[model samples]
Target: MAENASLLVELLTEELPPKALRQLGDAFAQGLVAELRAQGFASPDAPYTAYASPRRLAVLVKEVAAQAPDREIVVKGPSVKAGLDADGRPTPALLGFARKQGVAVEALERMQDGKHEVFAYRRSERGARLAEFLTGALEAALKRLPIPKMMRWGAGDAEFVRPVRGFVALHGEAVVPCSVLGLAAGRSTLGHRFLSTGPIELVRADDYEAVLEREGKVIASFERRLERIKQGLAAAAGDAQIAADEALYTEVTALVEWPAVYEGHFDAGFLEVPQECLMLTMRQNQKYFPLVGRDGRLLNRFLLVSNMQVDDPAEIVHGNERVLRARLSDAKFFYDQDRKQPLQSLVPQLAQVVYHNKLGSQLQRVERIEALASAIAGLLNADRSLAARAARLAKADLLTGMVGEFPELQGIMGQYYARHDGEPETVAAAIEAHYRPRFAGDALPGDAVGDSVALADKLDTLIGIWGIGLAPTGDKDPFALRRAALGVLRILVEHELPLDVVELLQAAHRQFPAGTLAEATVGEVHAFMLDRLRSYLRERGFKADEIEAVLAHQPTRIDDLVPRLEAVQRFRALPEADSLAAANKRIRNILKKAEVVERAPKAELMREAAEQALFDTLLSLGPQIENHMQDRRYTEALSTLAGARNAVDRFFDEVMVMTEDAAVRDNRLALLAALDRLMNRVADISRLAA
Candidate 1:
């Protein structure tokens, strides 16, 4: 056994990519700890802390051993029977193995390997010392980091995400003798770029963070720095809400070592532009957090996280304000120039913009979208003219200066520009909503008109992209066809629209040029959408079998999918559900094998008492199930079918349908066919069987 002590390792480097800082730190810490545990240098459950800043990556591990424990080593050789001949004399195989181990044949031990006794060499092996193994572990951990690109500094062979300036490797109160990235490990590390006076020395492995904060004027822990920034923002926000997302906060946290939040403001005139534009410039370009009033409007003031803290920070605040003014001025200029002309005038420019070489230009795609939107609007009983108008102008904003600068503002800028051209409210709203539900958990289109255009846009992309042999295959959907399919499914299922998905696909296919798409494209895309629907339903908490039950029928009208699934759930809970489902499964298997012609069950053919009784019960339940199904009362229909479980069970147990009489067998199969049809009207209950 070796003495154990805490360990610290840090890599001081140039400024890292802020967006990847957190992930880099986590990977560095976890990778080092994993290698340490694997090499027996640290315990399985050792406590550790990861420290990451813009200029450094570090980890502190507690209870790391200076050396691994010694253990026994075994090397298996020839089997006992082979190693010894009839007179128990050592054979050549055993002699060779013993010679390799540097021992005599009699020193070999015989042990059972599986069922056969084998001759083996056993010895005690010394454990490795930390100083001998630490560098290798560090190299392994660095090799596994998720660095997208590696750079070499000063023409050296060493390569890392950034130029490495220093390395720190400490065990307890002593510096470990190790080297990495062509740099020797030391106890000294630089802190803040401007605030700290000189290199900070760590006297012990445990004092890394404390000394960095107190003397070096830097916060080593990423999480602690983030919390401090959050507290400062909340205190400075007063009544205004901080209009920042987690991504912004994380990036800002990575940009600073000792974060100090400062308030800055822009001219009130910049607020005249859409708040989305202003907020995008501030957050995306400047890394600033904008403030929003209670009324959900952007305030002129914004908060910025700075690395330096001063008693009077007027210079920093004014400098940030000045920088933001230039960005806002650019946004305002784009907005002003974009509004000078109506959005419709830009539609013709889409002719030169290639959507895809296989699929026509943007102008042609817009034409297809326009026609499909009209057709979908007619199906939803929405304003067809409005849908068509919205679809025609949707891609027009792509040519605008505002949208060109901030591509995220494509649809949103279209809405503003549409309104400026005095377009109808419904048309403008539809133009924006056509791109709804862009990502998971986003909102769907607001109205039927919007839904119509959205479906058209997504359907065109899915059918067109898929028709050209670019369907999503093993996570290689460069065109995001999977997302488009999900968007279409969400619109239909969530809105409860009575549109047939296949019919919609056909309508979209018609808009394409003749002979451009394969004839089977419609059916293929429909099947793909159903696969996406299964995943979507599973995420909504439906059981796999339950989803299969509803989808087994391959229902083309998917708006009723949820209702059918809900009914199946209720049916599954019935006291007789298990036996009934088992019977249905048995029936399906029997019918699959039976060779019979179409015919109703003849009264005279049903000879057994149990068979006749089941026939009567099915007849009585037929009208009730039909009425429930017709009224869309799927739960009631399944409940009504459950009433025949006793008859079904009795028939299966007593009936023998494969008789010498062919007519009787065919008639019995027909009876079962009717029963199967009624039972599966809502869903294939057989899938629920255990």
Candidate 2:
């Protein structure tokens, strides 16, 4: 057996797509390790380090075997009865099998094959060497990489995300001979395109990362490079805060092998444009981090991550500033050109832009949203006129120059333009906030008018898109109906608004033509929203069964869903909760089997003491539970129902519900039906049963 040692593989290439660099690096490392583990060259849980930079992708896996363990081979031969003649003598068939195995018929072992005995041959086979399998493993890993598109370089048929420049494969101090993408694997690779003097040599697989960083001036690890960039930005910002997201940090890390953060500034005069516009241009176009002062306003200054590190970065700073000035100038041009006209003037132009071919134009959609927003405002007791005006202008900015340049600035530019037009403050704010909670954990609209418009907007999309039979299927939600549904649920439940989901969908449907939608669209969308609600509640840490208990009722007033789920959770902890839940489940089964009509229990039909006592208890608890339910005190109502557990258990234990007397059985079924109503007012407690 060959000794086990760490293995290293690196691929040097042209600059990779910055946005996809992290994913590519992860796929490359995991893919290689997985394939190696599958082939028995590495352990199942082998530790590996992934390295990704602008020009390289590499992985170092620990404790990889030089050769796999030897395997045993077995070949089953003819059955004993077929192999022998009537006198139990060897036949020609058995002799032919023995000749193939290079052994006499007596050397064959007899083994049971199902119900028949068979002759078999077994032998030991040598394990595969690392050098024999490394090339194939490397090729398999590369083929499995998550490269959406592959490009071919030169005249060769070899392809990758970018042109392959070099390759390195090492096991301890030895080079595992292999070839990939027309490149022969060696122990040397280029580092930091312009920083290192020449190709760096790896003496051992374990020293790859350290050697690259020390001699090649390249930080091989993506995470380490990202952290270094973050620390540099923080230190350079000093008093000001850097305006950058995780995505920006990751992209910058991918663009640099040796990251050096430098500060640059644009003319403060460009601050007249909305800070969002400036910040987006700096981050998206120039890959710079915009600085914000303690006052929460954009500063003229920004930070840039450069691949080049030098004693004096004056030219680098000047070059970046000059490029950003051109980009910011374009943003300013769009903003100024857009503000020349009031946002309302752009509404008529929306008719030229098609929202969807199945649906009407953007103008028609905006009108629907206006009417729906007004209706929702009435439901919330907010200013209907303000909501209508906000919705009317919500998509108008989509026709503006600034929005055309930056689609993400649609609602934001609308707010700025609305304010500039001297529109009502509430309406301006609503126009901007109508798109709140755009993604998960995002903030909700700040005011009632915004809430009304936001719900109206999302509900309109959910109904219209789903109405035309374009509902999401199997992760394909091009219309984003799932997102819109989740947004509506979040607003209703989070805001605790007094609106039913079905009612909102109905109102949104009405905003369209009489025959515009399918009749069942409202019910279908409600069910879909309920599914999203289940997942949403689970993410909030509610148990699956508890959520199902409350959702079993399919309550339209989702504002109280959390309270009902909480009540179910609390009820599950009670001493009698299990017994009551089990009894409820049993009672449900009896009623289902009996198929009895629902009615109030008759006092005259009660023949047993336990039955009468359970009846009296239900009557006594009815008003208390009703009052608690009316007050929306779900926990109190469930607690009150818990008091009836003893009576419920005794009734089931003492009385036979399915009796021989038809009248008695009917009466008892009615009694259980009445109890069922009270127990399930808050939630179906039976779902909580073990």
Which one wins on lDDT? 1
Candidate 1 residue lDDT tens string, 139-161 = 99999999989999896899999
Lowest-lDDT window of 10 residues in candidate 1?
A: 595-604
- Candidate 1: residue 314 Cα off by (Å): 1.0
Residue 660 deviation, candidate 2, in Å?
1.4
Note the Cα lDDT for every prediction shown: 0.93, 0.91
The candidate that achieves the highest TM-score relative to the unseen native structure: 1
The C-alpha TM-scores of every prediction are 0.96, 0.95
Q: What TM-score would candidate 2 get against the native?
A: 0.95
Give per-residue CA lDDT, model 2, range 345-443, as digits (tens).
Answer: 989999999998877899999999999999889988999999999999999999888888889887999999999999999999999999988889999
Model 1 misplaced regions, further than 4 Å: 77-107, 115-119
| Model 1 quality (TM-score) | 0.96
Indicate the worst ten consecutive residues by lDDT in candidate 2: 1-10
